[model samples]
Target: MTKNNAKAYWKENLRYLFILLSIWFIVSFGAGILLKDTLNHISIGGFKLGFWFAQQGAIYVFVILIFVYVRLMNKLDKKYGFDN
Candidate 1:
């Protein structure tokens, strides 16, 4: 790839990484700790959102995020002609 195109690809990858990490932090730490009480007002299947996040939801989200990142990165690599 040309220099400009390579720079653009790296920029896009960094942007996605930042966005995904931000969401992960929000779900794991923000919702689980900082906003726990506020979220507790609402419940799902007898479990409070905040409590669920702290106890189990964060782990699940992390797993899903890993898969999502892998899928997105694969697509990005292919699009940028970086895939083998």
Candidate 2:
């Protein structure tokens, strides 16, 4: 790829990474810790939502985000002609 194309590719990649990481942070830290009390009022499968997020929910979200990132990266690669 030309220098300009490479730069643009990396810029887009970094943007994706930033957005994904932000989501993870909000789900893990915000829901799990910062908003625990408000979330605790709700329940999922008999477990308090905040507790669940602290224990299991965050993990599930992280895994899902991993798949999302993979799919996004695949599309990005194709867009930048880096799929080969």
Candidate 3:
């Protein structure tokens, strides 16, 4: 509850947020666009990996990231003695 603790908690929260978002951006943008050609050489369920990422992979990754974020934040809350 001290100012320093609050600041540290927020800083850690932001760090987690940044890391999660970066993973999302890399999956959505990198696989879907920047690395499309390279990934195109591979296929999943008869669909090109790159194409799948553009249409569906990104979404799956996003959902997974959400769950991961929630789990991580819960741990963080416990670490900071803020959990109920």
Candidate 4:
């Protein structure tokens, strides 16, 4: 890739990475601990929201985020002419 294209590609990649990571962190740390009591007021399938996130919800979200990242990066790669 050309210098400008490479720079653009990396910039977009980092932006996506940062956003996804921020979501993961908030779900795992904030919902699971910092905001646990608040979230616990809500329930899902008879389980407390906070407890679910601490045990399983975060893992589910993380897996979804991985798929999201891959899909987004594929589009980005195509846009930047980096895809095969």
Clash number by candidate, in order: 0, 0, 0, 0
C-alpha lDDT (0 to 100) for residue 18 of candidate 4: 94
Query: In candidate 4, which residue pairs clash?
Result: none
TM-score for candidate 2:
0.92
Clashing pairs in 2: none
Q: Whole-model Cα lDDT per candidate? A: 0.93, 0.95, 0.93, 0.95
| Candidate 3 RMSD to the correct structure | 1.3
TM-score winner between candidates 1 and 3: 1
Off by over 4 Å in 1: none
> Can you write out model 4's per-residue Cα lDDT over 25-84, one digit (the tens) per residue?
999999998999999999988999999999998999999999999999999999999999
The candidate scoring highest on TM-score is: 4
> What is candidate 1's lDDT per residue for 12-37, written digit by digit as tens?
99999999999899998899999999
TM-score of 3: 0.89
Worst 10 residues of 3 by lDDT: 1-10
User: Which stretches of candidate 3 lie above 4 Å from their native place?
Assistant: none
Candidate 2 local lDDT, 13-57, one digit each (tens): 999999999999999999999999999999888999999999999
Clashing pairs in 1: none
lDDT of 3 by residue, 9-72 (tens): 9999999999999999899889999999999999988899999999999999999999999999
lDDT of 1: 0.93
RMSD of 1: 1.1
Each model's TM-score?
0.91, 0.92, 0.89, 0.93
Prediction 1 TM-score vs. true: 0.91
